[model samples]
Target: MATHSSVAHANLTVRQTLLHQLFGDHHGWLFERLRARLGCPSDAADMASETFVQVVALDDPHSIREPRALLTTIAKRLMYASWRRRDLERAYLDALANEPEQFAPSAEQQVMAVEALIEIDRLLDGLSSRARAAFLYSQLDGMTYADIARELGVSAPRVHQYVVQGLRACFEART
Candidate 1:
C-alpha cells in the first residue's frame, strides 16, 4: 500500500540539520548522566560521543521520542564495553607479569589472547563452579586433563567432559 518514495523517506535516518540540533540539545545532559553513572568525567564524555555514533548508525534514529532515555541507554552499553576492556587489559597485564621476561608474546598474539579471554569469560557465565574451573584450568593454566582431574578430585574423563561442555557453550554462543 505504501509508495516507494514514502518507504524510501521512512528509511532515511536523522538528517544532518536535525542531528546537529539533537546533539546541541541533548549531548550535555547525556554526558552528565553518564558521568554520574560511570564516576569518571572523561569516560562519560567519550561514551556520550559513542552514543551519538550509535544513534547515527540506527535505522530509525529520528523515530526516538524520549531522547534522554535513548541516549542514556546507549551510553550505558558503551560504559559496559569500556569496563570489559579494562578488565581484559588488567588480566592480560597480570598474565604477562607472571611469564618469563625472555618469552614475551607478539602484540598480535596478545590481542588475540585478550579477545579470546573476553569471549571465554562471556561463555563461562552461568556455568557451574566445577565446569568453569575445568575450562579455566585447561585453557588458562594449560593443565592436562589428568592434572585437572587430580586437582578437582574427579576422573580425567570427567574433566575432559567438563571442558567439552564449556566448548559446546562457546560454540552455541557463536551460532
Candidate 2:
C-alpha cells in the first residue's frame, strides 16, 4: 500500500514521462510546419515545444478538435507575441529619440527672479489695505483700474495711484 505522498510522487513522475513522450513523438511534425511558416529553426523549435507543453498540461489532451489546428493556433500566438515585442521596442526608440535634452536654470536668472519676487512681496506688504487690494486686483488678477475702482467703490484716479505707488515702491526696493 502506497502512502499519499508516494501516490502524488508517482503521479508527477507519470506526468513528466507523458510530457517527454509527447514531445518526442510530435516535435518533428510540429517543428517542420512552424519552420515553414516562420522561416526560422530556433523560433520554430521554441513555439513547437511550447505548444506541446501546453497541450500535455491540459486535463484532456485527446479532446483537441484537431492536432494540426491546435498547433496552428500555437504558431499564430507565437507570431503575435513577436510582433507585440517589436511594436514596444519601436515605441521606446521613438520616445528616446524625441525627448528634449535636460538643463538647469542659470544662476543669474534664478537670483534675479527670486530677488524680483521678494521685492514685489515686500512692497505689497507696505501698502495701505485699500491700496494693496486695488493694486493686487490690477496686477495679479488682471483687473483694469476702472474695474478695481468699481469693486472698491473709489474713483479710477485713486485706483491708478494705488497701482503706480505699488509699482514704484517695488522698483525702489529692488534697486
Query: lDDT winner among the candidates?
Result: 1
Number of the top TM-score candidate: 1
Off by over 4 Å in 1: 1-3, 10-22, 36-42, 58-65, 123-133, 142-165
Q: Per-residue lDDT of 1-175 in model 2, one digit per residue for the tens?
A: 9999999998888877766766676679889988998899998888887787678768855455566777678768767766655554565446545756454345575456445544455567678988888877988789998889999999999999998888887778779
Name the lDDT value of residue 157 in candidate 1: 92
Candidate 1 on 117-169: residue-level lDDT in tens? 87777788768889889998998799999999999999999999899989888
- C-alpha TM-scores of all predictions: 0.66, 0.46
Residue 126: error of model 1 in Å?
6.1
TM-score of candidate 1 relative to the true fold:
0.66
Error of 2 at 59 (Å): 5.6
Candidate 1, residue 23: the lDDT equals 92
